[model samples]
Target: MIKSLSVDETDTNNIEADVIVLGRSLPGVVVAHRLRQKFGDTMDIKLLDLSGVVDNYSSRNVTFQVPLGEDDRQRESLDAADVYIGNVAHRYIMHYMTEFNIPIPETLFRTEVSDPPQKMYQYRDGRVVTSPNDYHEFSFLNFFQRLELNNYQSSLDRRMSELFRGRREDDADSRTLRYYDRTSMESDLVSFLLLSESRDVMRLVVRTVCGASAHSVSLLFYLHQCYRNGGSRNYVGGANTSLREKLLGYCRKRLTRKLQQSVEDITFLVKPIKTIRTYSDEQVIVETTKGDYNYVCNQLAMAVRPEELSKISFEERLLSNLWEAVESARGLRPRQTKKFQVKYAEKFWRQRGFSGEILSVRGPILWAIEKPVYSTTGSLEKYSTLVGFLEADDEDEANSREAVLAQLVELFGAQAASPTEYRETEVEGFVPRCEDYVALRSLARTSSALVVWGALDLFADGDLAAALEAGHSAYVRLVLSMRPQAQDFDDLSAMQWRRVLPDTSFVTWFNTLSYNDGFRYVMYCGALYLGYRVFRKYIIRS
Candidate 1:
């Protein structure tokens, strides 16, 4: 059973713990659990949550009624559309789940039965075009168009592989990495679209997955996210389904199957932290809003969102010292996403021989996928759950439930008009859009007792796997600090969290041809030749 500390429970003047972790996110939980596993009962470790919930990620989960056997209606199903287990988070999540005896859910791509038809339909100019296994097989696309699409996809993957895994110790490659980081995805897309593009496929793909327009997203950040956690092969095309489809199939109302054990051994406190005052690398005082007690801990790990830091008060020295991190956190812009699900009694799309996957440029619905539901006995049920996302920040009309249903009706016929249950959730969170991740890294503060960990702080990626990795790294650092003699762990300690502002000056950008090293070199040679010619002409005239 889940347990938490009440307001009256923490009425003591002082509460002491060896370590205190703030934020109930996966990263914070991992840090607390790892520390407990390492030190056992020897150390007093405490994990705190403001929301009074262990897994804050699953807080948005919706539970609804599903009819059970003969006059009993207790049987129910979970709908967890937002939580997606990516390839990066798979290994770490599996390890913890197995240790805690958590049951894994079925995969969206490979099921007990044969694979479903693999296709994503795009509603183009008055017609629906299929996203096929091979672009060559797409009859609507001409040979040149097909060739361009294939080239673009392969080139993107290849570039991402190099930027992420290539030897960055080299100067040329390092500069190249920085170049991409300073560039926007929209600029890259514009260059590609200039070559007689038939449709805005790249824009659609980026918008559907990122939940933001290409112009706002950093090129390097976008590619890094796609490249991380097993890259594009796990989600897009061929054998695997797209990210949108995976989210739809993964709609679970409860995470019990995923999290049977809630790390019950550790002491759990339910209070919103008001301030963190750091004196040295080894000692800090944490104050909560509800309790008169002050938490004195040897170490404090921050696993919350970057923006959340503004809510808590820190010592003046720590704030002045970590100014770059504070600014980067404040610089992060909000990315709004609205997810909706409609449930029906029948699998209408399957009956019509449809894949239930759609990508549309039309109003309201940006993307949609059909998910299959199973009964408690592990048998496929005769129900349809259509889950999709809409652009919440830009589309004002698409904000309503009625607008969504009308769009669905237009796409899936009269049956879409009535859904047994319709639910929608709108989320406004800070994403790594235009933020300088290089600066965010400065918040690592590994040497200090106040270790900060945000989604974009270290790996510059926001996937669950990255968060788990961060938690593990923080644990190792904390351990090494306490035990200086131990050196078996990987040397991830060299990563600097200092933020470096990109050179956006007009002269600097002009000289580098907007960060194009190759083009700049060409211009350099041209200028030298022209200069020599002018000198020769002056000498002859004299």
Candidate 2:
């Protein structure tokens, strides 16, 4: 996926495209595919990809498929992978697969035997407790403690569901979303949950799910992510099959060859553009670094990060509040996370009657799931692996085989001491949270001819679901620009409506101020007022 193409400047003249999609990541591909499906031979869409830049934030590469013969029950395991598909993602993906006659992966089609087919356990107090639900298994928690946990979880779920209960276009829901976006997940948890234990538990869940601390993530973003993925229940409901892998696998297996033969071209490796010159909304002139190539296109879809977009110079017409947001986003550091897999000779945890799915509040390791190795004959292998995330930022520490294995030994037993092979992958350059949701709202309100959405954008919610959703939004924006009379736009087509931001507003902060916060503010204000009164009455008169 990281290869450069060196072409002569004169060859740029051959690049005649009606639409040019920048960044060939999952979102970019989906946008192009959707466009091609609608326009057919009428439009010439070209994919322009930059090496090592696109898909750096994606978790898709974390997990992959290793086929077990020609059977449907294909052995898809983790290099270090995490995929969460909620109702929204599942519905759209299923529709897309059905339309294209692509085979649905077995992971998505599995039947639910119980309340939850997969059981998740949390590592706590030198023992493991069932997570989110299954109260009977929570032996570590007292009756009262369990009650508090259950209450906190229920409230969280209700709030997540209520975020978009009505319609995306509804004024009430919009306001609610804005209010949530104007607040941090940390703030919400601290205010809503009474106990610090409850707060810590919630924060741990947020970190595991979103790969960022609760304080750094907006409440709206977290809720929307959970809601979109089906709900908070399904969001933290253990590991699911990799949707991104499935989609990409289908494209590589079925569509790549066929697409190459069509009018649309998947230009995998292209040099970075020097400038994007637009005379009108319908006319786009893209110049390469050498200025030897001029790719003339009618429209442009930028599925790149803000930093990437900052590289290319564009005319004033293409600039808006979104451009300003992009300027602000370029300087923001993305959320970072690391993935590791510990290969062991035996399933030691399973021997102790544990499911091997472990979550921790304190960690170098935050969340882990058992990944049993499978032979080509579709039988289980003696060796098994524990795949999960590392909370460490330092490269040496994250990649440290001993540090990870030591933690495993503490959690499991002495049996976890010897690992056959240890592997680690560091993932960075994720979508960072904006300073406030008002910024996102302002950006969303501003419409532009150029459709832009990125997997690494500040406004992005930092998940494959968001990328997929935003891709369709980009396509809708492009389509609406071309055909204003088009009535087929989905309810989720508006990108502005979905792009969430952090709650950093002073006004919002004051409005949702807690009893403790209100008391402190009142005390500080009282002290200041008293000092001012004394100075004015005595010092000024003298």
Candidate 3:
């Protein structure tokens, strides 16, 4: 039987736990799991969320890519040629394969190239490096033969030439030999020979309202996070299923089954709690939608968003400072962010010789992922799917959808472009807004006991994984300090608390330098910096 805990019938005096964790999210779930894993069943731990399960799916489906214009002008020029090469080759091979109904290879690993148009251009260290088009294709064909997919490759090439019989020889050459060969070479070489190469190429760029800018975040931190264990590669179920199903499976596996109870009004204790007065040595009184309750604990852990806490009344005015930090933090509007999943009718995309992924410089959709998963039979077929994420509001959603569809049609033709399903999740207060909150610790007296946690605390430094990690660390320290046997709490040393909490000064420095001038500047510069760093470290790292 699965053990479950519920707040609906919680008794304050009966509350028996060494630790009580409030709120539920990725961070909360992690903290709870860690505690349970380390301490076992000895501690009575309870996790409370107004909503039973944290719905990460709200903003999970869509992953953003940086605009093509952001690439160096010289690299862009090369990519243009690469695009021409890739299209021609892909189109020819796809036509060839289709005519013979040959099964295209299920996996395609394209080579990443970084050749600036001019020698004068300084290539950013760790950016992707691609080979010349012809060489790239040769490498791909070599790999195909090694993998014993040469039959498919030959048939594809032959069919492609036949399809374009009347076209100019150069046009045919561009499509059949140049593009097809280079793409194949790149994919094959990467899979077979230089498997250890770390190109740091930009694969998928996801845009969300995280608490901080991209540059300030550590690259390694996100690689292991964002998804649960096993990382992105293990998460692939195949092209037949949507990404959402896979993600939900991960969440289900890790989330605590015991903490599935609903939180009722009367049983929850609210801090600086309204409509209740505490007597000397009396426990903190709390009022909830369900009823009234009291909590007696040596210490408290607050995991609520700062803005939400600001609405409550507090006896001491000093508490307002915490709220001020929260308001100053960045946030997102509900309708501004959207998530989409688009599926292709068949695996015919590869027959056209295109990688499953595409980035548009000036298109309605910013990025597309091809064949995100596989089928039961293990054959790459017409049932392949592509997932696309676009930035749009309710008013622009329809137009954006149409625009993305048109782009797909242009790239893969009408037969390959069709919508399976589209989902929109309106997330409010989504962006990171926490850097300043971390800095405020400097201004806070060592005697201050109140500390706030949420997006404001996490995003202040512009690193989501770091922020979440830091938040967890802070909670651990706070809990340790409050322990009866801990030296700081026993001795009442303010200095000890400083060492336990974050260095507010460092947080402030990052907030000021990175998120200066509010949301707009952060949106353009801060986010881009964060995205690029993440791409280099997590997405591209081999």
* Predicted candidate 2 versus true structure: per-residue lDDT over 1-542, tens digit per residue: 33344445345455677788887655676678777877777877777776545332233433332332442344333221122333665555444444554554433323222444234444445455554343223434666555555655555656654455444433445666667777888887787666665666677767766667888888877766666655565544334432222222332333222332232344546777778877656677777787655777777777666667668887766664366665655555555566777777777776665656666666777766665433334343334777776676524443557767777787677888888888776545353363554455344334356544433233232244455565666677677777666536452333333323333456334434444554578899999999999989998789
Candidate 1 per-residue lDDT, tens place, 160-186, comes to 655554443222365566677677778
Worst 10 residues of 1 by lDDT: 70-79
Q: Looking at model 3, which ten-residue stretch has the lowest summed lDDT?
A: 116-125
Residue 380, model 1: lDDT of: 54
lDDT against the true structure, each candidate: 0.55, 0.57, 0.34
lDDT of 1 at 282: 59
Give the Cα error of residue 278 in candidate 1, in Å: 2.7
lDDT of 1 at 265: 50
Give each model's clash number: 9, 2, 55
- TM per candidate comes to 0.73, 0.73, 0.46
After the best TM-score superposition of candidate 2, give how far the Cα of residue 161 lies from its true spot, in angstroms: 3.9
**Residue pairs with backbone overlap in model 2:** 86-229, 182-503
Looking at model 1, the pairs that clash are 78-252, 78-253, 79-252, 79-253, 80-251, 80-252, 439-499, 441-497, 442-497
